[model samples]
Target: MKQSKVKWTKSVGWLLFLMAIGFFCLQIGYLIIQPRYQVEYIDNRIFYVINMLSIICLYMALLFLLTWKKIWTVVVTTMVTLFIIVNVVLLVERNKEVKNISSISPNLQQIFAIKQDTETGEAMYYRSYYGILSRPKDRLEPEIAGDYKIEWLANDIAAFTYEAEDQTIQQFIGTYGDRQEDSMSYYYVASQIRGKWGADNAQVERQNNGIAITVDDQTELFGWDNVEQFGTLAIVLKKNNEAVWAISLDENFVANSEEIEPTVGNISLYKATMEENDPIVLAYQGGAF
Candidate 1:
């Protein structure tokens, strides 16, 4: 029975020693690959704790195998303590250098995050498709600077505007859905009208999913499915199977006009129910137009 007990102790000690060696090799591999790639941990603190525990296990295994050797215990304990302290300092410094700003889409189907390096003032944008578990984030804007202003052009389209380091305004679009899927047959018409148009207090924005009309603090949305185009001359917006608004383009405006910019055009807005009312002329402000 004494021999069997000794054999069991040897087996357990060897097993733990193998595990500790495996963990140590993994740490070395991580260090080698870390500079070449960006490594993400779901929980950083837990990862550090696990590594520290593995080092402790190695110390315990060495003590068991060598029958409580004093030198092995002291050296391994000191190494383990130093490992913990170094990892803790690295984690704290990393947290201080990086800042994450995130926002959820209006439909709650997607999430966008910006990982900004505070020291260098460099920012990278990422997006994730939300599901039971969100997939790995896909990198969007690789490098940008300054504060970001996000606007949802549609449920799946985000427009990010920011002032560059050179003090010029720049915009980046994060489109999660296919443009063809939403516009379909009226793709050209949709493309032409997709922008912000204004006339005094009234504003019209043709988005990926819908047309947003705002007047004197009141806004109404007409889904793309409810919008009808009559060539490039005009478009009618419908709500509940009834025409609510009509937009008529300039008579001289040609779909293929080389003289005119895509974003520059004149348009008139009239209440479909009351055509007698004076139409509003809206000038193109921004977007695809």
Candidate 2:
């Protein structure tokens, strides 16, 4: 009976030790891949839940290793229960706060929000525009007093700048004026058309001056300015040997091809536009191809 009791104690200790290691690995992995955007709200929720569970597991493992007894087990169980309840309450409050903020600040478009700890008042603030997902709001040091205030300013800057860029692209594309609702990039739009029509002989070429389209024995050229003539850009698609839709950059406009993030270049292609005739229209507003 004495030997059996010793063996049981060793087995319990080893099991708790292994569980602690497993929990630690889980916590490390979560930290690595936690979502940073409000667009990934589901992922954010899962990360938080897993984090809380890992903490509980680690704490239980410690308790078990320190005192292998029924009382320690009871203590750990009670702590886990309390921790779960508290976390759930916090989650509910956070969801409510997010909803309220969204309704009140319709323009803010909360991509992600960082809540302050009720006890410790610390958080990492974040906001995002259409730029690369991981880019910071800004690099300049702010004159703001608090972290939250500084973050608010950063978000405002990013949003305003991105909004201006968006307006510029739209104006260049002439989406509000002569251009039809259905428009897309020349490359994608042409490929889609060719695929749909089963025209294996169709070809598209991007030249220094503009784009050239050839089908069978016929050829047509749509003129655009070279890189030196910044902002003189246009996208054209032809179907049945005729131009379907075309948009060009305004002559007065200047191209801003500066990179937003490390690898992502400036905005060039407008999003895929669909027309009544099922044509995909894309506009080359500005920047490199």
Candidate 3:
């Protein structure tokens, strides 16, 4: 009877050892596939806690095999229970975040797919606006050479006009397309837009001298039926700023509506624009744009 009990305990320990190894493998595989998902907004406290729990599980699994004592067995069992409880809590929170993201329409979801340059880690994300594929440049670090101001026309929409040293007036307007709850830092979004539609392929329109990346109509493309509501991010840049203004309009307003402004978020954006007195200070603002 004693020999049988010892054999059974050893088998259980080996099974736990295999589980520990599997857990580590799974974590590594996930990291390899999805590096962006690791970025945490609530600080990294939760990440550290998870790492600590994983370490404890590994230690307990080792002790279970090294020592058959009842005290060690109890400790291993307790640690496993704790690990399971913590993981369940985290999984629930992750599900909630997923639900929030799912609220976005499928057509819009496809527009946000980000591709990163392996060497530079720079990302390129773009969306089709009307028939044009609009994207931002890598110059996320906005240069405040002279007097310039970014005014928020709405909670998720903003506009700015500036004149470069070469007497060229630059105008840029953008909308926060992602849901407010899941919107990433401005820097992340800018990085994602930097290179998807390169400037080379884009042709400047004769009317506004603003560049547009055009594409043929596709059934799979979002906004094929109703192109207005599916608009994600739109920017109209004018060459030499010749009476140029790009306004994003949804179902609420007609295209080229002089009164309409760029819109974002499900909630109606407030019609308020806050002017930043000192534009150079934006360099220190750090990616919150």
The candidate that wins on TM-score is 1
Instruction: TM-score each candidate.
Output: 0.38, 0.30, 0.25
Poorly placed runs, candidate 1 (over 4 Å): 1-8, 35-53, 70-72, 99-114, 121-289
Q: Write the per-residue lDDT of candidate 1 for residues 61-153, one digit (tens) a residue.
A: 776677756786687778878988988887777667776555567888765556667787776655443221123343433345555566544
In order, the Cα lDDT scores of the candidates are 0.60, 0.35, 0.36
Residue lDDT tens for model 2, 8-37: 766776676677577667656545654543
Give the per-residue Cα lDDT of candidate 3 at 249. Answer: 25
Candidate 2, lDDT over the whole model: 0.35
RMSD of each: 14.9, 16.1, 17.5
Q: Could you tell me the TM-score of candidate 3?
A: 0.25
Q: Top model by lDDT, which number?
A: 1
lDDT of 3 by residue, 1-289 (tens): 9989888877877776776676676556545644543322122123434555566666666765685578867877787778777776775665443211101122432222222233443333333232212332223112223344454434344445444344444444445553323333322222122212212222112112222232232111111121112124333423322213333322222122111333222111111122333211100111211
In candidate 1, how many Å is residue 107 off? 21
Residue clash pairs of candidate 1? none
Cα error, candidate 1, residue 213 (Å): 13
lDDT-wise, the better of 1 and 2 is: 1
Each prediction's total of clashing residue pairs, residues at least 3 apart in sequence or on different chains, is: 0, 7, 1
